[model samples]
Target: MEPILSVEHLSVSFTRYRRGLSRAELSAIRDLSLTVEPGQVAAVAGESGSGKSLLAHAILHILPRNAKAGGSILYDGAPLTPDRAAALRGREISLIPQGITYLDPLLTVGAQLRRGRTDPDTRSRCRKVLERYGLGAETEGLYPFQLSGGMARRVLIAAAVLDSPRLIVADEPTPGLDVKSARRVLGHFRELAEQGAGVLFITHDLKLALSVADKLVVLREGRTVDELPAADFRRGQGLTHPYTRALWQAMPEHRLW
Candidate 1:
C-alpha cells in the first residue's frame, strides 16, 4: 500500500549568529526517515529535544525562519513543497499540537473551531466535530477559560480534525491528561487510522506508543535508531539497537527492582 506520508533523509539545521560577525550551524535533525501508510499509526518516540516536534513542523512547512530543511518529504506520492504544504495545511494535513495552550484565549470555542468563519456549513461542521468528541453543543459557547483540561484537549483535537485530513500529525498530544482520557484520545486516533487516515503519533512514552501504534520509530538525538513493528515490543523480540533494547528492558512492567 502506498504511504500517505513519507519523510526520507530529512535533516534540519539552524543558522545562528554569534558575536559580531561569526555564525554557527546547528543540526537538529539528521537523516531521519519514516513512513505512515493509509490506515496506520506510526509512532515517533524519543525524549524531549530529540527533534520530535521538529519533524512535525518540517512536514507542515512551519519551521522557523532560520531553519533549513534538507532531503524530501512526500505526501500522497507527490513532493511536498512549500506551496503545496501551505495549500494542504489545515485542509488535507492536520496537527494535534502538544498543549491546550495552543487554543486561543480570546476566541470562543465555536469561533476558534470555525477559524472566524461564520458560514453555515463551516459552523455546522465545527459543531459536529465537537459532538463526535463527546462535547456538547453548549461547548461552542464557552471560552477556553471555562473548559477543563480534558475538554481543552478534546477541543484541540476536534479543531484539528474538523476537515478530516488524510494524515494526522500529533505531537505529544496526551500530556497532562489522566490515563483514562489519554486512552480515549489514543482510541480515537486508532479509529481515525481505521477510517483510512494515516497518523504520525509522536511522543516520548514508549508504553503509550505500544498501546496504539502499528509501527514504532525510535529516535535518539535527532536520528532514526530503530524502526520496528509494535508487536516486537509485545513479543520481546526483533529489537537490535542497544538503545531500543534498553528502552524495552527499562519498562516499568519489565523492571526487576
Candidate 2:
C-alpha cells in the first residue's frame, strides 16, 4: 500500500543574528526521514529538543518566520507545498497540537469543532465524535479554560478526528494526562489507524510509542538513529545503534544494565 504521508530527508533550521549584522543558521532537524502508511501508527520517539515538534510543524508548513526547511514532504503522492498544506490541513490532514493553547480560548468547543459548518450532518458528527471520546454532548458548550487537562486532551483528539482526516499529525499529545488517560488516548490513535488513517505519533516517550505504534523511528539530536518494528524494540531484539540500545535499556520495564 502507498504511504499516506512520506517525509524524506527533512531538514529544518533557523536564522540567528549573532553579534553585529552577522547571521548564522542553527539547524534543528539535521536529517529526518519517515513514512506513515495508511492504517499505521508510526511513532517518532525521541528526547526533548530532539526536533520532534519541529518535524510536525515542518509537515504542516507552519514553521516560524525565521525558520528555514528543506527536503520533500509528500502527501497522498504529491508534493505538500504551503498552499497544498493549507488547503488539505483541516480536510484531508489534521493536527493534534502539543498544547491546549491550540484551542481558541474564546470559542466554545462546539463552534471550534464545527469549523464554520452549520449543516446538521456536521453538527451530528461533531457530537458523535465527542461522545466517542467519552465526552458528553454538553462538553461542547464549555470553553478551553473550563476543561481539565485530560478533558482538553480528549477535546483535541475529537477535534482532529472531526473531519475524518486521512493523515493525523499528533505532537506530544499526552503530556499532562494520567496513565489511564494516556492509555486511552493511545488507544484512540490505534483505533484511528485501524480505521485507515495514517497517524504520525510524535513524542519523547518510547514506552508509550511501543504501546501503540506499529513502526518506531528513534530520533536523537535531530537525526533518525534507528527505525524498526515496535516488536523488536519491545523485546530488545534488533536495536543496533548505541542510542537505540541505550533507550531500550533505559526503559523502566527493562532496567538490566
Candidate 3:
C-alpha cells in the first residue's frame, strides 16, 4: 500500500546573519526520511536536537519563518504542498504536541475540542471523546489552567483525536505521565493505527516508543541512522547502525546503562 505519509530526503535549515553581516545557515534536519502507512505506527527516536519535531512541523508546513525546506513530503502519493497541508491539518492530519502549553489558557476544554464548531452533534461527540480518554463530562468546563499536567496532556490527545484524522503526528506525547498512563496513551496510538489511521510518533524515549511502534526510525545528529522493525530493538537483532545498537543496549531493561 502507498504510505499515508512519506517524507523523503527532507532537510530544514535556518538562515541567520553572522558577524559582519555574513550569512550562516544552521541545518537542523539533513536528508531525513521516513514513512507512515495506514494501520501502522512509525516512531522517530533520538536525543534532543535530532530534528524529530522539525520533521513533524515540516509535514504540517508550520516550520518557522527563517527556515528553508528541501526535498518532498508526499501524502497519499501526491506532493503535500503548504496549501494542502493547511487545508488537511486539523481535519485529516492532527498534531499531539509535545508541550501542554499548546493548549489555550483562555479557552475551555470543550471549546478547544470543538474548534469553533457549536453543533449539537459536535458537542455530543466531544463529550464522548473526552470520556474515552478517561476524562469526565465536567472536564469540558475546565480551562487549561484548571487541569493538572497529566490531565492537560490527556485533553490535548482527546482534542487532537476528535477529528478522527487519517494521519497523526505525536511529538514526545508521553513525557509527563506515569508508566501506566504512558503505556495507555501509546496503546491508544496503536488502537488508532489498528483503525486504519497512520501515526508518526516522535520521541526521545526509545523504550517507551518500542512499546507501540511498528517501525523505528533511529535518528542521530539530525539524520536517519537506521530504520528497523520494532522487533529488532526488542531482540537486539537486525540493527545495522552502531548508534542504534547502543541505544538498544542502553535501555534500562537491558541494565547496560
Candidate 4:
C-alpha cells in the first residue's frame, strides 16, 4: 500500500541569536525519514527535547519562518508546500498537541467542534466522538474551564477527528489521565486506525506505546536511533540500540511493582 504520509531526508534547524552576536544554527531534526501507512499507528518515543515535536511541526509546516527546513514531505503522493500544507492541516492531517491548552477558555466545547468546518451533522458526530472517549454530548455546552483534565483532553481529540482527517498526530495524548482513561484513549486510536486513518503518536510513555502502537520509532538527541515492531517490545526482547534500551528501562512498568 502507498504511504499516506512520507518524510524523506528531512532536517529542521533553528537560529539562536545572543545579544550583539552572530546567530548560531541548531538543528532540531537530523536527516529523519519515516512513513505512515494507512490503518497503522507509528509511535515516536524519546526524552524531552529529542525533537519529536519539531518533527511534527515541520510536517505540518508550522515551523518558525526563520527556521530552515531541508528535504521533502509528501502527503498522498503530493509534495507538501506551504499553501497546500495549510489546507491539509485539520482537513487531511490533524494534530493534538502535547497539552490540552489549544482549546479556547471562552468558547463552549460544542462551538469549538462546530468551528472545524463541520456540517449540519456536527452535533451528532461531536456527541459520538465524545462518547467514544467516555464523554457525553451534554458536556459540549460547558467551557474548557468547566471540564476536568481528562474531559478537556477528550474534547481536543474530538476536535481533531471532527472532520475525519486521513492522518492524526497526537503528542503526549495520555498525560494526566488515569490508566482506565488512558486505555480508553488508546482504544479510540485503535478504532481510528481500523477506520483507515494513519496515526503518528508522539509520547514518552513506553508502556502505552507498547500496548497501542503497531510500530515504534525511537529518537535521541534529534536523530532516529531505532525502529522496532510492537511484537518485539511485548516479548521483552532486549533492544539492540542503547538509547532504546534506556527508554525501555524508563517505562513505568519497569519502575513500578
Candidate 5:
C-alpha cells in the first residue's frame, strides 16, 4: 500500500538573536525522513529538545515564520507546501500538540470544535468523538476552564478528529493523565489505526510506545538513529544504535525512582 504521508530528506532550522549580536541559525531537524502507511502507527521517541516536535511542525507546515525548511513532504503523492499543506491539515492530516492550550479560553468546548472543523456536520461528529473518548455532553457544553485537565485533553483530541483526518500526528498525548486514562486514550488511537487512519504517535514514554506503536523511530540530535518493529520494542532487546540504547536506558522502567 502507498504511504499516507511521506517525508524525504526534510530539514528545518530556526534563527535566534541575542542582544547586540547578529542572528544565529539553530538546526532543529536534519535530513529526517519517514513514512506512515495507511492504518500504521509510527512512534517517534527521544529526549526533550531532540527535534521531535520540530519534525511534526515541519510536516504540517506550522513551523514559525523565522524558521527555514527544505526537502519534500508528500501527502498522497502530492508535494506539501505552505499553501497546499493548509488544505491538508485538519481535513487530511491533523496534529494534537503536547499541551492542551490549543483551545480558546472564551469559547465553549462545543463552539471551539465547530470553529476548527472543515465541514458543517462537525457538531454531531464532535459529540460522537467526545463520547467515544469517554467525555460527556456536559463536558462539551462547558468552557475550557470548566473542564478537568484530562477532559480538556479529550476536547482537543475531539477537535483534531472532528473531520476524520486520514493521518493523526499526536505529540505526548498521555502526559499528566493517570495510568487508566492514558491506557484509554492509547486504546482509542489503536481503534483509529485499525480503521485505516495512519497515526504518528510522538512520545517520550517508552512503555506507552511499546504498548501502542506498531513501529518505533528513535531520534537523536536531529537524526533518526533507530527504527524497529514494535515486537522488538516489547522484548527490551538491545538497540542497534548507541543513541537508541541510551534512550532505552533512560526510560522510566529502567530508572531507580
Candidate 6:
C-alpha cells in the first residue's frame, strides 16, 4: 500500500536581514525525508532546534512568509501543493498542533468541534469524541480559558480526530497531560492507525516516541541523522549514527550520560 504522507528531500530556509542591504539565509530543515504509511505510526524525534515542528508546518503549508521551502511533499502519490493542502486540511488531513493556543478563545469546545455543522449527527459525534478523551458532554460549554492545561490539550485531540481524518499530524500532543491521560491519547493514536489511518507523531520525547511509533526518524541540527525501527531504538540496536546512539544512551534506563 502507498504511504499516506511522503516528504522527500525537504528543506526549509528563512531569509534573515541583518544591517541595511545585508541578509543571510538560515536553514531550519535540510534534506529531511520520511513516510507515514496507512496503519502505521511514524515519529520524528529531536531536540528543540532540530526542526521537528517546522516539518509539520511545511507539510500543512503553514510556513512563515519569510521561509522558503524546497522539495516535494506527496499525499497519496500526488504533490501536495498549498492549495491542495488547504483543501484537504481538516477533512482528510488534520493537525493536532503543539500549542493549546490553537483553540479559539471565543468559541466553545462544541462549536469548534462541530466546525459549523449543527446537525444532530455532527453534534453526536462531537460529544462522543469528547467523551472518548475523558471529557464530558458538559465540557463542550467551556471556553479555552475555562479549561485546565490538560483539559485544553484533550480538547484539541478531540477536535482533531472528530472528523476521522486519514492522516493525523500530532506535534507534541501529549504534553501537559498526566501519565494516564498521555497514555490514553497515545493509545488512541494507535487505535486510529489500526483503523487504516497514517499518523505522524512528532515530539522531543524519545521514550514516548518509542512507546507509540513503529518507525522513528531522528533529527539533529536540521537534518535526519537516523531512521530506524522503534524496536531497534528500544533495544539499543541498529543505531549507527553517533547522535542517535547518544540519545538512546541518555535515556534514564540506560543512564550513560
What is each predicted model's overall lDDT from 0 to 1?
A: 0.91, 0.90, 0.90, 0.84, 0.83, 0.93
For model 1, state the Cα shift of residue 20 in Å. Answer: 3.2
TM-score of 6: 0.97
**Against the hidden reference, what TM-scores do the models get?**
0.93, 0.96, 0.95, 0.90, 0.90, 0.97
List candidate 5 stretches off by more than 4 Å: 116-121, 249-257
Q: Write candidate 4's Cα lDDT for 1-257 as tens digits.
A: 89888888789888999789988889888878788889999998888998888888888988888889999999888898999989888787999877788899989999888875456687788888888778877888999999998889888888888788899988888888888888887888888899999999989767778789998988777778888887777665867887777766666666656
**Residue ranges of candidate 2 with Cα displaced over 4 Å:** none
Backbone clash tally (model 3): 0
- Cα lDDT tens digits for candidate 6, 48-159: 9899889999999998999999989999999999999999998899999999999999999989999889999999999899998899999999999999999999999999
Q: Candidate 4 vs candidate 6: which has greater TM-score?
A: 6
Off by over 4 Å in 6: none
Cα displacement (Å) at residue 197, model 5: 0.7
Model 2 Cα shift for residue 96 (angstroms): 0.5
- Clashing pairs for model 2 are none
For candidate 5, what is the total of clashing residue pairs?
Answer: 0
Clashing pairs in 3: none
Better of 1 and 5 by lDDT: 1
